[model samples]
Every structure is written in structure tokens, then in C-alpha cells.
Target: MRESPIDDFWVRARAAVPTLPAAVPEAWAFGATATDADALLSLVLDGTKTGTASSLHDCEADGDALPEPGQLSVILDGSDLPRAVIMTTAVEIVPFDQVSAEHAYSEGEGDRTLGAWRAIHESFWREYSQDPRGFSADMPIVCERF
Candidate 1:
């Protein structure tokens, strides 16, 4: 089985994340022909898992250091699906951390809100809301447009 680019990226990002308590080894593959942005997040929200190969538009930043606006990384374990893909991107972590701290006893989307996790995802919800460049004590990021 071949590893997807996203998978490869994560192998590297993992080093930065450090070993945490809750970590799920994930892999993703990218098709340059794949659509741009965290469009994958929308697909997942609609309960879609199958991904299509499309032209990949480069994000605003460059290099593996992570872009200011943030770059989307991915992983792919080509064990079964030839088009296997997974995407991970940046989001507001501080607000999420705060919400999690106060609402240890809450319900609903709070279970997976923007401030709920640093889990694997690609949506720049901040682009649509007021949480642009939001950061946590662990992950600090500059606020730039995607």
C-alpha cells in the first residue's frame, strides 16, 4: 500500500503536535486534481465520506512550516480504496479550549464544535466567522485569510 501525501504530511506534523493523550493515527491522500480549501469539511458535515480526485489549488502559504493563513495537510493509506484521502487543517483552538473547559458538562455540536477539537479537519470555519487566527496555549497561529 502506498501512503498518501496527506499521510506523509501528518507524519511530519505529528512531530510538531508532540505525543498527546488523545491521538488517532490518521492518513490522507491528495489529488492535485482535488478541489481547493477544506471543502472536505463540508462533505463530512453532510455525512459524505467518498472523495473525488480534482485539481488541487495551492494554499496562500508555502513550505512545511505551515502557512500564516494555514495550509491543509492530509494522509492516505492506500490499503483498500485507490483514492483514499484524509485532510487536516487549522481552526480556532483557544475558544474551543475555553468552551471545553467550561462545558465539560454540555451537549450538542459542542461535542465537535470549532473549539471542541484539534482533531483532523480541513474547514477554515474562521473564514466564515469571527474566530480567525484563533489559537490555544499549545497551537499559536497568525490570522491570515485562506
Candidate 2:
């Protein structure tokens, strides 16, 4: 079996900014997918994207867990190299249909509008899922802002 990749990002990060919390990062992950991950990480590094939303159904489907406020997460690029670390500042669970415009703007996707985010995310979820029902208005979404 191939061993997982590892690096000294944590050590270097600590040296670069001494005031960061002492708590170790709780998770390491790339974005939702290769292309999306790279794009989103760019947004993050450029200080444009401050928040993200994900379908709770999708998380369950993928057997991944939700993130919580105060948890530090290492964001990685498409190549799986750690690039930046963000401490989740807030987390909320809301229905897909109920997502607010402010939250969508923080996502920094196409046009940075709620409608655009909805259209894009709806298409993404439908394509991402194997379930016959696909994306639904009432589906619970994890709205996380960091």
C-alpha cells in the first residue's frame, strides 16, 4: 500500500505566525473536488471566499463529518499539498431553499449572488449524487463560514 503524504507545514506555519492558537488542526482536506478545490483555495488565498456551503445529504453520502466552529482545518490544493489553514469561525445548518444572500456572497462563486450560488450548487449536487432524488429544496445544508 502507498503511504500517505506528509509535510512540515504545521511547523513552518507556527514559525511564520506565532500568535496562532496552540490547538492542533482538527482536519486536513482538499476541497470538494479537484477543480473546485483549486478554484476555492484560490478564492480563499486571495481573501475573497470566506465561507462555503455543502449538502448534509452529500456529507452523509460520502461518510464525511461536518465541521464545527473553532476547529482549524488545513486547506490543500488539487495536488494534495497543504496551502493554508483556516479556523472555522462559524457553522450553521439550514435548508437549501433557506440559504441567505449574505452567505452566498461570502462563497465568492460566479457573480457572488445567491441565485447564482443556488444554480451552481444545485447542479453540482445533482451531478455529485447517485441518489435518484438528487438535490432537493428542503435538503439540510451545512453553511460554514471561516
State each model's CA lDDT, in order.
0.32, 0.82
lDDT of 1 by residue, 12-118 (tens): 56666654223334334332223422344344434443222110122222222322222332333223222222333322322332334222221122244435433
C-alpha RMSD of each candidate structure in angstroms: 16.0, 3.0
Whole-model lDDT, model 1: 0.32
Instruction: Give one digit per residue, the lDDT tens place, for model 2 in 41-68.
Output: 9999999999988788777877777998
Residue ranges of candidate 1 with Cα displaced over 4 Å: 1-81, 84-110, 118-138, 141-146
> Which whole-number lDDT from 0 to 100 does residue 103 have in model 1?
25
Q: CA lDDT of 34 in candidate 2?
A: 78
